[model samples]
Target: MNTSLKTILTASVASLFPLGAAQASEPATSGQPDTVLIQAKKISAPNVDGTSQAAALSASSDSAALLRDVPGVSLYGAGGVSSLPAIHGLADDRLRTQVDGMNLISACANHMNPPLSYIDPSHIGSIQVLNGIGPVSNGGDSIGGTIRVNSPDPEFAMAGEMLRKGQAGAFYRSNGHAHGVNLNATHASDAWSINYAGSLSEAGNIVAASPFKVVSQGNGGKPGLAGDVIGSSAYKSENQSLQMAIRNASQLLELKLGLQNIPYQGFPNQRMDMTGNRSEQLNLRYKGDYAWGQLEARLYHEHTRHSMNFGDDKQFWYGNAPGMPMDTEGKNSGTLLRAGLPLSERDQLNLGIEYQRYRMNDWWSASGTGMMMAPGTFVNIADGQRDRFGMFVEWEANWNPNWFSQIGLRAERVSMNSGPVAGYNAMAYGNPASPLSVPGAFNAANRQRADHNLDFTAVARYTPDSSFSIDGGYAMKTRSPNLYERYTWATSNTMVMNMNNWYGDGNGYAGNLNLKPEIAHTLSATFDWHSANPDQWQFKIAPYYTDVHDYIDAVPCSAASKICPGRKDGFLNLSLSNQNARLYGMDVSASALLLSTEKYGQFLGNAVLNFLHARNKDTGSGLYNIMPLNAKLSLTQHLGHWNTTAEIQMAAAKTDISAVRREMTTPGYTLLNLRSSYTWKQWRFDAGIDNLFNRFYRNPLGGAYLGQGATMGQGVPSGIVVPGMGRSLYAGMQLKF
Candidate 1:
């Protein structure tokens, strides 16, 4: 490694340590440098201050929390630190998450660790969410949008002269017992910089609602919402990140690597005796100034290994879940490269190429691992893999100083290899009476393959002046059948119902080798107006419509018992499907500096409103689990050494739940949060209370899953509801030398 690179890595590593203990005596003049503000795209937003002033307050926030304030954005908060950002009524695989221009897919099926889990909040230098009008350099097929998180990268004029030498800092935070410590640090030199961040959170029964109450027909057919088993329900999750960058007169290069591991004793759905996951990622990039304009290039690779098991004690309780008996493993790998160049004063170009692969395996233990079935009874229902490669290019030319048009095209090639892997299908036959009832042995020779995919997009923007602009675009996108959607033949416990459900098979769920990718054509427009002087005020409004063909939905199949005569209750099953969908929605957001310190008391106020309306013609039901109209308001007071903030959030009632499933309506509810900090020059103390009111209400989607017995004669309903959290408190302190 080059000495500069070594120095870079070292600085980032040091940031991982607890540096608050070290003091230089005098207060550091500069805390963090100001970043070049990118136009706040609806897709990505980065919060610089400790509080989420410009965004909606979130219970669980990752690097992408900055965009919560953007119009038409909602987050699925699974825990206190894990969340998935949704945009324009789209989320999950539709939205892409990038760290330093790299993608790190979480390994868990429940999505415990989303894109934001890879970095520590303290180490983030800046974040940008390209909610709408996504830059072509980010590639295509992102219906929701993309989020970008950049580390500390700065340039010095003298090259070797240090107008101000960037220094390193670190801090650690720990909660009560079972709570693990989190550490992070960073250092910046005149020409380059490095940073490291990590966290270890081990907690038992995350403090639940006080005097908790249970509904008679709550989750898992359990009597009452059982008080957490305290020590029995425990979890441990950790993340470590290392990043280094070199900056010269006109060039910049960076490399990043990261790893994370998580293990838990019990989760809500699963009978959970134990479950764990491991993930890794690496990325590299180079950027330099060219005579015509600027040039940027980047490459990345990522892999994730996920293994989970339900202890024997409870393994038999939940029927036919995939990877049951504690030995299921899933893997994913991908690589991507992107480049951009400014062709001329009035034109620019961005292009990218990317590849991705995914695989899953199910094996039984050799020893008597508590299974009634024979040992070593391994079955490979998902002997499937997909290789997807895509290249996209965009050209931008200004018709006038204030008006410009952008056109983009993307071509993709997707090759799939799917079928039984020799002994894979035959083994499942042993379970003649179980849901693992394979129709018949499939020959490895019966494998199938498919190829060819292309997408297109065109956009135009007109800016009459610095204060007003409007933009819109048209795009066509497609999605192929995933491994689980096509080749899965075994029972799984990870779907809407916690049963040994088959994704698709000869039964109600049939695989269509001839299935075509879902195609969508979309169009949208945005209007923005802003004023920076005097009291700051900015506002943006967007409207969009999309029509999709061959859209897939997991509709009910034939009776599960009909396929497998020996099976008990009809097992849950779905097949390769298609439908037609048309959607339209609007997003509006605005922010203003209600008060300025120079003219009035040291106080600030901000508020945001987010709304969405979606429909599914196939089901004639509103998009499943779509959040209704919601809004958040916050106020902050700043004094010499103290800053205090309070926030209120409101969620509107929602009547949209998939039919076969009775939609549980969520009455409107309100929540309050408070936080404050005292800064004494080099050191700062922080504290906050979440859900200060201890209000009790369940999220519209909480446990809103199809129950295993919904198809049985049992009185159980189609969807189950999980309650939200009660009041909670947290505090931390930071120091700078």
Candidate 2:
């Protein structure tokens, strides 16, 4: 440990106890507690409000990064904007993410446009994370948790009066020379209101400063030289949205339109980078209050166009390789309707129906001569479609003040189909008589597939006293495979296999048509302890376990199938299959008020710990890309209009990894972070320094390093792990009027 870092930590901890006794008798804050609670599933759920949102926005522009502080949540970084979030060790498409009640699907084969990337943090008004257990009304196509993000609520003025308000904010960071700006404006009258929000952000290449030695055999043997600046990691993007609302005596209607454009963005983990992306979305909703009950209806549609290719640093690796550019287009639309009714004085019933349809096409254009047997060849998924219809019913009961319970059930029907796929010059590729050329057999074998899925959930909470509570939940969840998992036809050519690179494992993959839907059974429990005083101390611990039947995994392809391409290296060409798996984890969090006084202000301390264990039931192998045991601790101080925070993040060495996937181990390390903010009138200022000591380390779940610098002939180790970001200083300011 660094001496300066030790001194700062000791001084901060030593100064708190002396004032603890004196402040215990002092009064608390002047207003209500700074916690907002929402009633959902017959329980009180905490809401991430404006203050927390502001702090998150000031830290990073990526929306997924904001969830890192949440218990039972972890991140798998692939690029500056394409980081995937995981819950209980399930990640990527396994989790359901909804923005403003719209289900947005990724348009790129490499998953460059995740659901969270659709909205900027500046436009988010509230976020709710339903940890492993969620209501059936949200969605049924995923076994993991659900994340719901909502835009700001519309404002209304008094009768015969009008109101206008606006806000502007900007932030800049030194690590990648990243900068961004956001603006929002609104006007409201008694019956109608309109609002607009927009943002723009850009960043240069990131520099890795970790000094850890490289242990992988693939990267060139330059031991400590793998942490140099990563190439093709720059990006720029813009987003805008408009919302209109109208209200009568007992009914409200709203319409929203959103647009996004990204000229270029690079991925350090995948084989290709995003050259361009453009998207548009429209959403409409109606809410009414009637004597019978409450009614709500919603409809939404989204379209996206995405393109990918090699970046400047990697273009030479191919040296004029033809058919270099790949493109994808996607359209997603859905409708939802729900009603709430009171069955009795102590019971309530809620019913809802949802429908979603997704269409996608992936194709690559050939460039240069002598590369393709024909003039133009497109070797990717074509005209792929997946549709889902779901209905759910939930019952909530308040048996007594000490007991609250909820039970829900959902049914979903999923159907998938795709057009015929073809490979270039069938005869030249050694499959002249086979269906590899036109893929006619492939189309006929998997033309249309359908699955009927069901889900059930039961949860209860017991409060023995005002300061103690216990919650327990059990759920049975199911998920159908995505389009790419079932429609990507196999090919002997490795180039075609490499096109389906979503996991960043540096291996080729093909889809399987005979895959079964994954089913998961989960049980979770939480224990909470709090002081009678609201501002004193609180602690919570949650433990969860999940058993997955037919879990998706990669398996080796047989030579007779002609689907596996022979690679000179030891890596194997694999395809998707179903296997059994089990996962268990625990999340612990605690917060305490160390001091509170009229003269000295307030001081608080917080800590969080997360652990996970996942394994394949049949093979007894650890799951790939599982997060290591990690913990975070922070101290916060507030005086007058100024606030400051000091944080320490630590992770244990990862020794349990998937041997089949050739996963590497990472050493444990610690990082320090600092932040401060000040407020005056309608303006606020924020500043922060991340990786304060500039300690160098690699994240266990950051994925493998696939940049050109790590290539076999590039001078650096070919299999070096991706390193974490270097030290960074950032500042921001916001004004509201």
Indicate which candidate wins on TM-score.
2
lDDT for each candidate structure: 0.52, 0.75
Which tens-of-lDDT digit does each residue in 1-737 have in candidate 2?
A: 34465455334533443232111111111111111112355542221111242555667888777677777788887767668888878988788888899987888878889988888878777666775567787757999877776778777789999979888889998988999999888899999999999999899877777543343332223322233666557788898999999999899999999999988888877667888889999999999999989999999999999998776444333434432688899999999999999889889999999999999999877655544424466657889999999999999998999898889999999999888766555543333245435365675564698999999989888876666667878889999999888877756566667668688766677887878899999888877656566456666678899999999887666522435657755344677788999999888876678877899878877777989999988778898888899998888877888778888999999888876666778899899999888778877788999999988888788666766543322243335567788898999887887
lDDT of 1: 0.52
Give per-residue CA lDDT, model 1, range 1-737, as digits (tens): 34465455434433432121110011112333123125442221221111232111112224455555556677653434455667666665566677767655543434444667666454455566654346555645455566666655543335454443333332222221334344455566667666666666555444444433322233254333244211123456677778777887678888878787766434433222346566677777778776655666666666655554542222223333333443445455666656557767777776777776655554443324333333444444444566677788878777786677777777777677654422222343333333244433333234466656656667777666555557777777666654445554443221212322221111223344445576767777776555424134445567777776766554544422223222232233444456666667776554444544654434555566766676667767765456788887766666667667787878887776544323456767798978776667665666667688878665654533221222222333333344455675665554454
In terms of lDDT, which candidate is strongest? Answer: 2
What candidate 2 gets wrong by more than 4 Å, as runs, is: 1-41, 44-53, 211-227, 316-319, 372-374, 428-438, 559-562, 569-571, 709-717
Worst 10 residues of 2 by lDDT: 24-33
Per model, state how many residue pairs clash.
19, 8
